[model samples]
Target: MSDALLSLENIRTDIAQYHILKGVSFSVPRGQVTMLLGRNGVGKTTSLRTIMGLWQAKEGTLTFDGADITGAPISARARAGIGFVPEDMGIFGDLSVEENMVLAATNGMPDPARLEWLFSAFPALRTFWKSQAGALSGGQKQMLSIARAMIEDRKLYLIDEPTKGLAPAIISTMVGALRTLKQQGATVLMVEQNFSVAKALGDQAVVMDDGVVVWTGAMAELAESSALQERLMGLSMEAH
Candidate 1:
C-alpha cells in the first residue's frame, strides 16, 4: 500500500501480562475511510491505541505518511497530523462545550469559519455551546467528542465506534457529518460494529479476529457477500 497514510505491520501490543494484538497488520489508504471490523475483544481498540502511541508496541513497525513512527510519542504523533477519537470519547466533563472545542484547537481559539462549519454539521453543538459537557445526553456527548477531533485538520483520523448506542436519527446525523468529512478528502481508520454504518461510509474493510487481521479488501466486496461476513464477523450483514 504505497499510498497508505498509515500502515501497521505485524503490530504486537501487550497490556500488563496480557498479550493483546498479536501480529496485527493493516493499511489505511490516503483520503479514504477504512473500517476496522471484528467482534468485541479482538484487539480492535488495542490496535488503535498502539497506532495513537497510547500503548507501546512491543514489536512491528508503524508508518505514517512514509515515515516510521513506531517509537514516536503520543504528542509527536498528534503533531505529525494523526487525530484520534477513542471509544471513551475523551472529553472534559467539567468544561463547557465551547471550552472543550477551544482546548482542542492548536491556537487556543477556534477559527471562526471552521467553527461555523462544524456548528452547521452538528447544530446541537451550537444549541448547547455554553452547557457543561457532562450534562449533555449520550448522543450529544458523542457529537462533541467527534467535533473536538475535527476541530483541527489532520492527515488521518482514528475513530472507534462512533454510533455504538445512538438512536437511528442521531446515527443518521453522524453519517452525514462523516460523509462530508470524506468529501473533504480526510483519511480515516475507524472501528465500527454497525454493519450498515460501515457499508455506508467505508471504502476499505479490515477484519480482525483473535488479535490478528483475518481479512482485508473493498467494503463493497464484503457487503455483497453474506457468507464472507458470517465467516469473518460471525454474523451476516442482514443480521446486523
Candidate 2:
C-alpha cells in the first residue's frame, strides 16, 4: 500500500477501569476492506469506538491521510471524514425513516447523491421512505444506519457487527452495498463475527485478543490458516 488512509500506532485506550486497547496498531489502505475479527470480548468493537473518538486513546497516535489526529475531539474527527455504524444500528424509533437519517448525521445536510445511491442499492429503504423507523424491520433500520454514514462521502467507514441477527438474504444485500462502497473508493474497516461474510468482503483481516492485535494479514491467509482459525477465532474448520 502506498499511503494508508488511516493508521493507528501503539494505540492504548481505557474505559473507566478497564484497559480496553493495549498497543494495538494497524493501517487501513485506501480503497480496501479490512475486517477486524475475533471471538466475543476481544475488543473489536472497542477499537471501532476508539477510532471514532468516543473513547480516547491514553497512549499512542492516530494519523489520517498524513495528519496527526490523536488529540482531535469526536466532532473534529467526524469532520475529518470518518464514518461509523455501531452494532446497535442507532435508529430513532419514534422518527420517520428520513428523519432518523437526518438525525444520525453530525455534518450539515445529508448529501442528495449519497441518499440516492443508498436508496437505489437498498430499494427496501425507498419502499419505507414515508414509514416511521419504529415500524420498520431490523434489516431496514440497518440499511438506514448505513445510508446515514454515506451521506457526506466519508473517506473511511468503521462498521460493527453488520450481519448480526439479519436474515441471510438481507445479509447478502448488506454485503452488496459494502462492495459498492469499495468500488466507489472508500476504505472500510469492519468488525465482524461471521467468517464466511468477512472472507467474502474483506481484502485484509486483523484478529484481536484481550485488547491486542494477535494477527494481521490478507483474507487469503485468514481463509487458509487453520491454526489461526481455531486458536484466535475459536472456530474448527471441519465444515459447516
RMSD for all candidates, in order, please. 0.9, 1.8
- Tens digits of per-residue lDDT for model 2 on 125-239? 7899789988988998888888778766788899999989899999999989988888887899998877788888889888888989988889878787788788876775334
Clashing pairs in 2: none
Cα lDDT tens digits, model 1, 6-92, are: 889999999999999999988999999999999999999999999999999999999999999999999999999999998889999
Where is model 2 more than 4 Å wrong at Cα? 104-109, 237-240
Q: Positional deviation of 143 in candidate 1, in angstroms?
A: 0.2
Give candidate 2's whole-model lDDT.
0.85
CA lDDT, every model vs. true structure: 0.94, 0.85
Residue 210 local lDDT, model 2: 90
Q: Candidate 1: which stretches are off by over 4 Å?
A: none
Q: Using lDDT as the measure, which candidate wins?
A: 1
Q: For this target, which candidate reaches the highest TM-score against the unseen true structure? A: 1
